[model samples]
Target: MHRTYSLRSTRAPTASQIQNPPPPPSSTKSGRFFGRGGLGHALRRNTAGAFAPDLAKKLSQLVKMEKNVMRSLEMVAKERMDVAQQLSIWGEGCDEDVSDVTDKLGVLIYEIGELEDQYVDRYDQYRITMKSIRNIEASVQPSRDRKQKITDQIAHLKYKEPNSPKIVVLEQELVRAEAESLVAEAQLSNITREKIKAAYSYQFDALREHCEKVAIIAGYGKHLLELIDDTPVTPGETRAAYDGYEASKAIIQDCEDALTNWVSQNAAVSAKLSVRSRQLSQRRRNNIKRRSEQGVGHDLSSQDAPLNDEVSWESTGQQQDEYDDAEEEEDDETEPSKHSMLLNGDGSNGEKRGRSQEAVAA
Candidate 1:
């Protein structure tokens, strides 16, 4: 019952803690009918899309589903900690070596639970970011509805009273509605892209950190296991006196230090894309850059001069072809240098070359 490695503290409650008391910890038991989530989760998920505006319905359900995921993670973290405590309790009646190893293992498992809890907090950040997107989607729905309603009214009047004076007024209103809808739609598009990128980036970084830390804990757990004497013994042959206390404590300390010092900069795992994936990613980035540049130029040119429709179309096509050709040439020039760097294993040369190429491009 000596819980030396437990994460709980015995200090008095802080002012903030006293003012805003934390909720009681949830039981490990699942609910009677609806499983761990109980009735609320099911109700929220089933009703999420029904009450949402048409434009935001799918996204609304997605947000609700993410909430369910977070709840499940919370349950899992709690259960993991419970399992760790159970492991330590179960090991108490065993022989010394087994008892010591299991207790240390419980410590590592409990740390994983703590890490999972922290991950849940960080994941809430991603969920909150996604909520921004859902809010924007909901706001944009009204403008879309207004535009459609106006258009329908205009069509009905044109059919019933072809020459009515109200038709002109409706047309003007329709134009205004269309403008507002356009602005709203643009805002939605921009915010959706921005928030989606940010939200997923946060989630992925958190996932990577959590996974790496768990792996580190597993590695040290293996070292602790090596201290156990798993060798078979003859009948009634008592094992040697338990003497791995210092070594086990050192391993635990080392693990704690490693966890404390762990940072994203020193992350040991990396994702390497295949050649085709890299090429596709590069092409996608290049296309987005070129299109953005072209859009700015097109906007400026339109403001400066009014060109004939046919002439503008032809010039735009020609400009697009020129951009494609230039991009191809740049890719060709960079590919050889990239390959050489990979072969030589000299990242500094690649960095210098990249800087020079960027300077030339500028």
Candidate 2:
């Protein structure tokens, strides 16, 4: 039997310890005025937003709360390991079947603790990503302040000195400030959306994996329980000798192999939506598509004036070409008639020609 499997103290490093080193003890004493919960957790939650920039205060508080959550998980993992060790120690003096099963259960429980510790690390990744959003929010505040200040100054000057030369200069400064603020606001919006999606996706993925692995451990723990003989025996009759030692060991090995090979794609549990849920989900998707189409239509309608202007300019150019061609054809037709009239020596044609020549000379 492995010494690591039991609570026996040994100078040499145990297999369990080597594989998953225990986390360091928390720096703060476990029990103070707040008991095991720690005073820092309460203080952190209540005071986190007090000093944060106005724009970032709420998110800053959220980040602090997440830190508290991580701390709680760490405490839980450590306690779980302690309980596992205690369980193994208490079972050492029990019947052979009881001892074997409890020890194996301890192994599974300790593995759960290790999984929790790892989950805390992944959760911190999410918290750090959220901090990026807070940082961007804090940086954007200055641009907003600058724009507001410029507008106030321009307003104050226009009221006190309506014709002040400085008003024009301040107006120019205000325009530049507004432009800078616009860019800063746009960057803040883009980064907030991107980081929020990334952070939550990371958190949910970690949570799913942790839960699935814990479920796997629980199932195998139940298998280990079956090794013990639970049948009612006569008070004087002794139970049969324990022959499940090898079987118990096999169960533990199988559990370890299962956990080692587990992956997201191989998850046994799934959330299958019911018919109503499927319909509701599809309806939501259709509504989003409809709204998007409406938005595109609105955008196109707003652009109609420019498109109409371009079409009118094209049509005007074509009309001008036709007008020029018509004038040239009319001039060609009239010139022949005027020449024939001059050949007949009509007095009216001669008089009109003399007047046209006099008007040209004039």
* Per-residue alpha-carbon lDDT of candidate 2 for residues 69-143, written as tens digits (9 for 90 to 100): 877887787677667767877787788888778877877787787678667877777887887787677666666
**Model 1 misplaced stretches (Cα beyond 4 Å):** 1-36, 295-362
Candidate 1 per-residue C-alpha lDDT over 1-362 given as tens digits, one digit per residue, 9 for 90 to 100: 23344323222443323443422322211122333376647865776656556776787778767767876887787677667767877887789898878887877887797678667777877877886787667656666776788799889988999998998998987777776666666667667778899999878987887899899999999999999999999999999999987787778777876776677777899999999999999999999899998884222211221222355335644644453343223113322322123225352211221111111111
lDDT of 2 at 272: 96
How many residue pairs clash in each candidate at the backbone level?
Answer: 0, 0
Candidate 1 positional error at 254, Å: 0.7
Model-by-model lDDT, in order? 0.65, 0.65
Task: Report lDDT (Cα) of residue 61, candidate 2.
Answer: 83
Q: Judged by TM-score, which candidate is best?
A: 1
| Global lDDT of model 1 | 0.65
For the record, the alpha-carbon RMSD of candidate 2 to the native fold, in angstroms, is 36.4
Please report how far candidate 2 places residue 129 from its true position, in Å.
Answer: 0.7
lDDT of 1 at 26: 21
Error of 2 at 138 (Å): 0.8
